[model samples]
Target: MQALQSLADNYNYFITIFLMVSGLYIVIARGNMIKKLIGLAMFQSSVYLLYLSPGKIVGGTAPVLDPAFTVYSNPLPHVLMLTAIVVGVATLALGLALTVRIYEAYGTVNEDQIFARDNKK
Candidate 1:
């Protein structure tokens, strides 16, 4: 149905929002470092979805240098998304590294435990 198609077309953004909220909830409520990483991945995946969905055109062609080709593909969004992916990966790596350090220092990754320990000092 046309209505279903329209829903599908907009579903990516909704899914992205869900992922982001789930990630935030995990980050706030979870006790494990690995779970937090998974949440972070989810958050980033949502962003990737956001970047990818808009760049797609139904009747667009790839931007090639062939003389026989027309319809220039909108490459800006793709390029921006590539950059975003790189930055996201870097941020994830950094976050993971920080988590590792937190684990080493606190012997537990739970936020409450960490806060309690800090308060004792």
Candidate 2:
């Protein structure tokens, strides 16, 4: 039971690392920019997960500064996660826009194919 609890406590962090690695793998192995964006999103989400995991308490409220509220939750992580998510979304949008530009310029989305054609030329 103790081991199980310990595992549960650290599970989110482990998952976060796993997701980060998976995202890195996708970004490195995939040729399509859209796929890379998807991978980037996964990485961002994992970071959010990491932030949220630390702020978790058994009983917590939304960290609103109200006089009536006595036991306030840790809002720092949540706020940071929200900001991170926004930044991540912006990055993804930018990446997708860049992919569109790449497609327009090269007429192909595959990196290998583009390189091959370039080499031939």
Candidate 3:
């Protein structure tokens, strides 16, 4: 009963792990460049969750100069995650632009076809 409760309390970590694994698997198994980009986005989302989960405290207050609050939540993780999100978005956009260029050059987004064409060249 105690173990179950502990697991339930920490379920967010498990979810983060699941997303990370699924994203990695999709990136590895999919041949489509768009699918790989989707997987990379998923992995980035999981990283956000991983940092935010531990920073949440049940009875914590904002880290202001308040003597009444003994427990204060750290804001650093949320701030860093915000920066990470912006960077992730920029990276995704760049990746999509590159994908478009790749398709224009190769006429297909599949890795196998691109490799075959390169071999032929």
Best by TM-score: 3
TM-scores of all candidate predictions against the true structure: 0.79, 0.84, 0.87
RMSD of each: 2.4, 2.0, 1.9
Q: Compared with the true structure, what per-residue lDDT tens digits does model 3 show for residues 6-120? A: 8898899989999999999889999999999999999999999999989978899887878888998889998999999999999999999999999999999999999999999
**Error of model 3, residue 49, in angstroms:** 0.6
Local distance difference test scores for all models: 0.82, 0.87, 0.94
> Which digits, one per residue and each the tens of the lDDT, describe model 1 over residues 36-105?
7778878877887787777777676776677776666678888888998898889889888998999899
Error of 1 at 59 (Å): 3.8
Off by over 4 Å in 1: 1-5
Better of 1 and 2 by lDDT: 2
Off by over 4 Å in 3: 1-3, 61-71
| lDDT of candidate 2 at residue 94, scale 0 to 100 | 91
Summarize candidate 2's per-residue lDDT along 35-61 as a digit string, tens digits. Answer: 978998998889998889878765767
TM-score of 3: 0.87
Q: Given candidate 1, what's the lDDT at residue 70?
A: 66
